[model samples]
Target: MSDDLKEFESDFATLAKLAVQQSEEDVRLLLGRLVRKYRQRHPELAEQLNLSLKSIQTRSGSGALRRESLSEQAPGAGVPLDRDSRLELLKEFDDRGGMSVPLLPSGLLRQVESIIQERQARETLLARGLAPTRSAILVGPPGLGKTMSARWIASRLGKPLWVLDLTTVMSSMLGKTGANLRAALDYAKRHSAILLLDEIDSIAKRRSDESDIGELKRLVTVILQEVDHWPDTGLLLAATNHPELIDPALWRRFDAELRFSAPDTELTVQAVRRFLGPDTEALGQWIDTIATSLKGRSLSDVERAVTTLRRGHALRHAPDEELVSAMVGADLGMKSKVERLTLAVEMAKAGKHTHQEISRLTGVARDTIRKHAGPSPRRGRGMK
Candidate 1:
């Protein structure tokens, strides 16, 4: 038999297996390739297959393949790339087992958990003639684990996460921009992978803004349509630090909206403890003092500060009290007199430092610390 015939047989065998298993997506994808392959050599056969393919894509209901799934597969079935600069448009991360749930507030954590649970139980929803959440928008200030949360959701579902590399996807030639985005989205849908449009506000600006050009606005239209018809097999996530810049119409399309705020005092303490890692035990005495000082800050900032303290303690053999004191002292300079007094009282109550040390570090009077905290425990009680 000719090599072409052998190839045809193999393709037919795989298609038959996929059909028997009711893998509609795989069947659709294979039929598409066969249609193209036979187009020139056997135009009549190709025409028949093409007609059937179009019918399958446009068929309405729960099991139909999305129209965008008809998009040509990216070369070699790898991540999509810009044709001009060959820059990769989608960055792939397969963290099937390694990713951990990001540190988040209790309320925000529940929202994230629900998203994962819904995706895992997608079949149950389909049975009831309902669709699972196909898309969500993560809105908040930066450095608050929005991206990490996307990773965790994908990890829990046992799927690879494909993050859109906006730097590469945004083309200088505006026409190519839309094409690039569609190609990337189509590829993600084809593989049923989680696709995160990080910093979506960049391209999804308000359409009413008069300064924007026609092509840029067209990008928003492309995204709006994709979000509306996103397949149940894939999860689409968009994250933005500035939600206001996103078009109002685009915002309404997401199935859920997750808001991430700065960590509260209790959450900050938990973040500090987690970030301290192995040194959490060594610096256990100053956890409350550190948490109080770091309150109102983002979790990322807390992690950075804790990491620096851990490094100093490990490398320079710096005492935990001195490191914590220096950090708190630097922060104290920015605080008002009342704020400093409050923090000083907190430090005293922690009983990890004497009144003299707390007053010196926080610039509060020793007498005031004693009056507020009802006197320090003892000299030896504090870190030497």
Candidate 2:
């Protein structure tokens, strides 16, 4: 027998035995999973089998069947599917596999989480004559956590993430882009997947731009219409670096409008501590100094800089002070660095450090300090 036939035989045998011995809950759960996988391999055959299975399941008097019924409602079961579907580049996957979730500020974290958490209570939301916020727009500078949050939602909801890659979705062929978007959204609705229209500003720009084609302007209206009618089960998320470019009407269409920014002090410190790992606890009180030095950088900047430092420190056997200096230097202005170094000299003198120790710590010789702060050196770089 072919491998496909062998696998089918094994699955069917297992399913058959489960039906005879397992409780209804166990049987229904396993049956749904079997059908889900079976649909991928033989959608037409699976659809036929699903109809027969549902007939038998209802006859057995199970009042509500979650997956067994929902799987049939998923895309392409009994419903006519488009032959010329233009959404080939769209990817579908579940979970981020424990990848790093960004440390967002509390306000923004709660905002993003509201949508994610509501998605879990979708049935409750719809049953009460309310719609769970289906669509959202994330506005932020590049390198913030907008994209990461989108993935995190998919993982949390345990739904396939349907990402619409604009480069592939946008086509020069007349009227094709709109069709592609509709088909993608339709798929998301049918599967209850998280649909991410990343970089949405590229198409949903304000209509007044003279350079933009009339069709490009019309796309904004089409997007808004789709959002208005988007289903409660599916989550529609749009991320953009420039929110100002999107049409104003489009702005109000989404239920949530979240603005993301670079990490503040607390979040930056958390990111630093996370990236530093065991080294953070080892540094004791000094970790706070490292966190303060990382204040102005984005989470990505800290990750890359610290990761590089780790590799260099391991290879070069550099001291912890080298890494600290690099992080602190990145956050300070050039003039600030000089001023701090000078201040360090004064601070050391005001304390117990010997002159030579102060010189080494400040990278300033005693004569250099006397020349500048002594009141005998030139008043300015060039002016006397």
Candidate 3:
């Protein structure tokens, strides 16, 4: 009986704290449910509890469960500047989020580094008659670290990053989208934060196309006006996958334009080793082979492949030799079971696994494995 009482009290205390922190309606509903259940069997206790709730509600004017006005139940949660609005247009971020900047090709990395240096030496640049690079457009395929570059720039400048939500800012309500965009830009100015308009192609597509609508043209013009007259204190950054779809004049507005591409085999190989750390140094030969096979793939692809390989090895789901053999077979893109099993058997033969284990690993019968491995006889001469 005592344990039951303690558990009930503990549950009530936790719910009460949650109610205070989150919503008052939770407390009202909880107490009401308890009172209704006990009213028939314990009349006096139920009455007392109801009276206590009434007293508490009367004590707090804002605690009443009155219906809200239509204005309170309206569409379009206000822009990020509104204090009462729930949605955030800008996702604020700091350096400690632990997302490492991705490896880039040489020319791209050099341009990004120059941008970082220019931002770091703002005063020095002004003294030397060179202006600080405040605006830039990163154009590339997806997963090339365009968004990461924006955050890295923010971190290096010791500033917070506010990436705008294009979904919320772009509205079908006629001219309201431009107003929302302006409001977001105004909010960014207050904190001197890095404002990343990621995927800018959605809004600033090429306005010269005959099939384009007037609203898109107007939106691009608004962007142009804002970019030209934007304040010097805050940084404005934009990124896109389809740079060709963006207006040509808009390209000229940016101080620096950085183009990104998929990493080559050499960089991918180095990235794979660096990502794997000291765990695979002894397997350097196999690691280099992984690099050679992953040519023409992006850095993001390499990260995913390496992560899967390391995790499979760490989890002990399969032995290291077996896992490496399977991954190499997959990376090599073998088309059928015969080719795949042949490769696996060859890999296992090169490694330490025996013939029976190699047969089991490759999902082939041992006799069939021997037939494929053994030299083919002169079939027509031997039979006919």
Tell me, by TM-score, which candidate is best. 1
Arrange candidates by TM-score, descending.
1, 2, 3
Candidate 1 clashing pairs?
none
Question: Highest lDDT among the candidates is held by which one?
Answer: 1
Clashing pairs in 2: none
lDDT by residue (70-94, candidate 1, tens digit) is 1234544566678888877887666
State the lDDT of candidate 3 residue by residue for 1-384, as single tens digits. 686475456545644553543334435545665678568866887797688667757765647654222123244333354233445666766663455666888888888888888777654554344556778898888876888888887777666577885655553343566666667776565445578887788775434555556777777787887677554445788888888778889889988898988787678777888778766664555565456445566667676777777888778778666676676556656445756565545534444344565554455666775666653232311121
Clash list (residue pairs), candidate 3: none
TM-score of 1: 0.76
Evaluate residue 85 in candidate 2 and report its C-alpha lDDT on the 0 to 100 scale.
49
List candidate 3 segments past 4 Å from native. Answer: 1-86, 96-101, 171-174, 204-212, 328-384
How displaced is residue 245 in candidate 3, in Å? 0.8
Please give the CA lDDT of all the candidate structures.
0.78, 0.64, 0.65
RMSD of candidates 1 onward, in order: 10.4, 13.4, 19.2
TM agreement with the true structure for every prediction: 0.76, 0.64, 0.61
Window of ten residues with lowest summed lDDT in model 3: 375-384
